[model samples]
Target: MQKFLFELNRNADFQSRYLSDRRDAMNGFDLSDEERHALAEPDIGLLFHLGVNGQILMHFAAFHEIEWQDYLQQMRDGIAAHGPVREGVYAVTGYEGVDAHSSRLSKTSDAEKGS
Candidate 1:
């Protein structure tokens, strides 16, 4: 996962290369089929749930033209739909109990109120 993210960040031509030929772009990586599918789908939620680092994930989100807020929301939605973060930096003990939709609504309301 880190290798894939690194390539996406370090290679100037990676996006074009990936878009043009995914199999070729991914040829040398040691990713599992599931990981490869996540990348292909650019499923930010699943990627986060799979324990991708935030720094790496942030860049990946940018690569997909997703804004920061949406990126965060996607992570939350991932938890809501797929359960807690599985590992890595974002893992937590009680995420399964979190009410993601209500949390999102609260945050949106707070933002609207200039808070």
Candidate 2:
């Protein structure tokens, strides 16, 4: 799926096919049903949750005419709806997620320490 996005970003002909018919543009790719659905349905948020690189996903969103702010919000909404990225560079290890991370920061802040 990542490769497909990269190709779609680089190739004008492929971009045309995607604009005309997303399923057909995706013909040769061995994408999972979730991947295919996200692409075909043009779900920007779902794709983010599926772990697509932002650089590649940004181009894909542009093809769909999604505005920049909307694209960023969709990715944020995807994380809220589907949890953190399931894979890719954004995936964190054992550390807790955003809420916990923020709480930890507050706990150690100078204000919280009365400094």
Candidate 3:
């Protein structure tokens, strides 16, 4: 994942090569079908859910012209529509069982009651 992002960002030659022949460029990497599909679709939400680092993802989003707000919304939508992050640092166990917004609201309510 990091390698793919790096190639997109750091290697102009790779970019040119990929632009000319996507399959040929992709063949150079060892990637899963899911990873390949995500890249092919440029599924930012899925990539984020898959735990691509924010720093890397931010640039990728910028390259795709996704605004900051839109990028965030896409992540939230991904969670709502697809379920919790499947892997990586952002993975959460209970996300599948509750609405994140409602969970936050419940916490806020508890805090208010205690106060």
Best by lDDT: 2
lDDT, candidate 3, 2-84, per-residue tens: 68887787788877876676566788688888887777667887787776776888887887788999988877776666667
Q: What TM-score against the true fold does each predicted structure earn?
A: 0.74, 0.81, 0.71
From the highest TM-score down, the ranking of the candidates is 2, 1, 3
Report the Cα lDDT for residue 50, model 3. 73
lDDT of 1 at 51: 85
Give the runs in model 3 whose Cα sits over 4 Å from its true position: 92-115
Candidates 2 and 3, the one with greater TM-score: 2
Q: Which pairs in model 3 have colliding backbones?
A: none
For each of the candidates, the C-alpha root-mean-square deviation to the true structure, in angstroms, is: 5.8, 2.9, 3.2
Residue 72 lDDT in candidate 2? 91
The per-model lDDT (C-alpha) reads 0.81, 0.87, 0.75
Cα lDDT of model 1 by residue, 1-115, tens digit: 7778878877879978988877668878998887888888888988888888889999988988999899999987877778877887666543443466578788999999995
Lowest summed lDDT across 10 adjacent residues in model 3 is found at 89-98
Judge candidate 3 at residue 75 and give its lDDT. Answer: 72
By lDDT, the candidates rank as 2, 1, 3
lDDT of 3 at 44: 81
